[model samples]
Target: MEKEYTIRELTKLCHETAQEKGFWDEKRNIGEALMLIVTELAEAMEAHRIQDQANFKEELADTFIRLFDLCGGLEIDIQEEIDKKAQRNKQRPYKHGKIC
Candidate 1:
């Protein structure tokens, strides 16, 4: 049987692949990539909503792939970073914090 990755594993895969491509935060165009995805989501939600299951999955996968690229471009190990940040947030007590 083929192996399946959990969400965290997939994220790690993206991070590792990013390293192969030499992603550096200094050279990333984060705003552009973010804008593109945001635009796609907005248009997709506003227009068809894509009721077709296969099509929806494809769109979702494309979105995540772009996000992975963005993470690579920013030189961020998203899974580790998110985990670290979550731990830091847990250590700090904020009544109205939105860091995560």
Candidate 2:
């Protein structure tokens, strides 16, 4: 069986790959990375609009990879933050402030 990688490990790999590809060179700003993340989300939205399941899945993965790359670059613990947010969300009322 293949080894399962933790979120942190995957993120580190993304960061390394970005560096190797010159995507994180001195000329590029963090805002560019953020923009790429948003672009991936837009692609996902377009895929969903057309009901393209394969593209939707691929775009979602792209979004996550961009996010993970950013988080890895910033030295953020995304999994830890996710855990904290999940615990906090559990204390909220049903449906919270949303109408639906």
lDDT of candidate 2 over 1-100, digit per residue (tens): 9989888888898888888888778755788888989999999999999999999999999998888888988889988898999999999988987888
Candidates' lDDT values, in order? 0.67, 0.89
Clashes of each: 0, 0
Kindly report which residue pairs in candidate 2 clash with one another. none
Error of 2 at 35 (Å): 2.0
Q: Residue 56 lDDT in model 1?
A: 61
Return the TM-score for each candidate structure.
0.54, 0.85
Candidate 1 stretches with Cα past 4 Å from truth are 5-28, 43-50, 85-100
lDDT of 2: 0.89
